[model samples]
Target: MDTIIKFRFLGDGDCPDWLLAEINTLSRMTSIKIKILGQTVVKYLTEGDLDEEKVRKITQDAKVELNDAKAMVAALELIFTSSARYAVSAADLSSELQQLGLPREHSAAIARLHTDHCPQITATLSSQSLRVSRLSSIEVLSCDNSSPFSTVSLKLKRLDGNVENSVINISKKDVHVLLTELRRAKSLMETL
Candidate 1:
């Protein structure tokens, strides 16, 4: 349950090639967006500096839509993390899990839970010592010392039934929360 904040710069595909390649590359990745005066914004990519005043002024001067710019930054951040194994899209996650020889049933369960029941997914993964969850609207996969480190959480939606899912290490606190939530959900389901 340790809160970790990570950021990444956007890439080149989403923005115009010219104008400013730095900005373009920096705007294409998935990142966390913070709102200022009802406008979503992000820290500067160059140095991880959070200067709202400067960012606002620059956006106003450049005529860039603040929300759009922030979206790009968020996307870039996601991509960067995905590339680094800290996070991944559903497809990438499945591939990684397959490589690790996880079972198809588990992968399917994970994908369904991740896409349709995120809280449950987080809880279930945490129960299995997998530190994978949705944070700030993006999926994050991580590991730490308290659990066995050779695990990965696969996206269930992408499984072909021929591959196995991966395992990951998660914290006890996270597992506890997940278990509690799962029990609550199960109780609710039983009532229904």
Candidate 2:
């Protein structure tokens, strides 16, 4: 049996309790296996070989811009590790992928995650706030487009599961500082 990696899935609303229970039951029966990968994440691997040829065809048809399969895997690894909530928002994921400077079409392939793809990936993005200690949502309120330097007003919902959000109206300079501090804080947290 081939091994499949269960990156990390925190206890989340992505899957309903009943469904999760059923998966657990099946796992216990040895029909499948659930491997806990970390304190807050679990990897679900199944015994089998994936249809790489099919994946290739899909990748080609989708015109994915990743330089190679490893690049795609690396991107996914960063994205999966970037947060503790066991999920990454499409918008946030886009920032990481867009750094590659792929064309819109190719980028779209990477950013194709929508509410339709999986409920876990999107959460209750329409109304839920996640209540988890990570980025739950982001809403762009306004962007001033005057010159090379532009200001943006953003409403970032860091809370999870339908709670009131934190709104910030900030300039580009402030965004840089905030991002720096955020990265530093993230680094500190990872050390723990």
Candidate 3:
């Protein structure tokens, strides 16, 4: 009803066969169990990685195959993370999951977890993501030798609030190659 929410993780809203089968297992779970699993998913989302020990415990408790449990967790992680990225409302997420064949109870549980932890989830996702270090500055010093060389000093600003500095002695040909590459990268960035 609300703009037909599309989850790219679900591949055009058609749930994968593997996930559809896993949903059956999830649907059969008790509400408490589903809530616990949803909490684990939220933890995984906030932490930006899965806890293997937690997954093992979940498999043992759910009495499902290890791979199946993993599949379910992975699917739920992608769904909720994608939903968060899209800024989908909790009710919309629930409806989307139901449309994807998840039971109402399970969808509602997952949506509730998302509603409770959306800010944390989004924050962690933004902070923990891998991004290219930014080049703060570059300085080139030329040697007055028969065979000329350049001392290149680079300052890089990393995502974690660290500044890294490096110095390289480069031949003239290498400097030309580096400039060409930098020009190419600049062109590509501008095109975007």
TM-scores of all candidate predictions against the true structure: 0.22, 0.26, 0.63
**Clash list (residue pairs), candidate 3:** none
Query: In model 3, where do residues sit more than 4 Å from their true spots?
Result: 1-13, 128-130, 140-192
- Judge candidate 1 at residue 178 and give its lDDT: 51
Tens digits of lDDT, candidate 3, 1-192 = 555545544444645577667777777666667778778888877875667787778668868788877877877787777777778888887887787777788888888888899999878777666445544333343433346787666554544567767676778668778767766765554443
Tens digits of per-residue lDDT for model 1, 1-192: 964322211221222233234334333322211123112222232234556665555555556577755553453334333333333344544343333333444334333322443333334334555433322111224334445432335332221234334454556556546547645754554443
Comparing 2 with 3 on TM-score, the higher-scoring candidate is: 3
143 in model 2: Cα distance from truth in Å? 69
Which candidate wins on lDDT?
3
Query: Scored by Cα lDDT, where does model 3 land?
Result: 0.71
Clashes of each: 25, 9, 0
Against the reference, the lDDT scores of all candidates come to 0.37, 0.38, 0.71
| Better candidate by TM-score, 1 or 2 | 2
Q: Which stretches of candidate 2 lie over 4 Å from their true place?
A: 1-49, 57-67, 70-88, 121-192
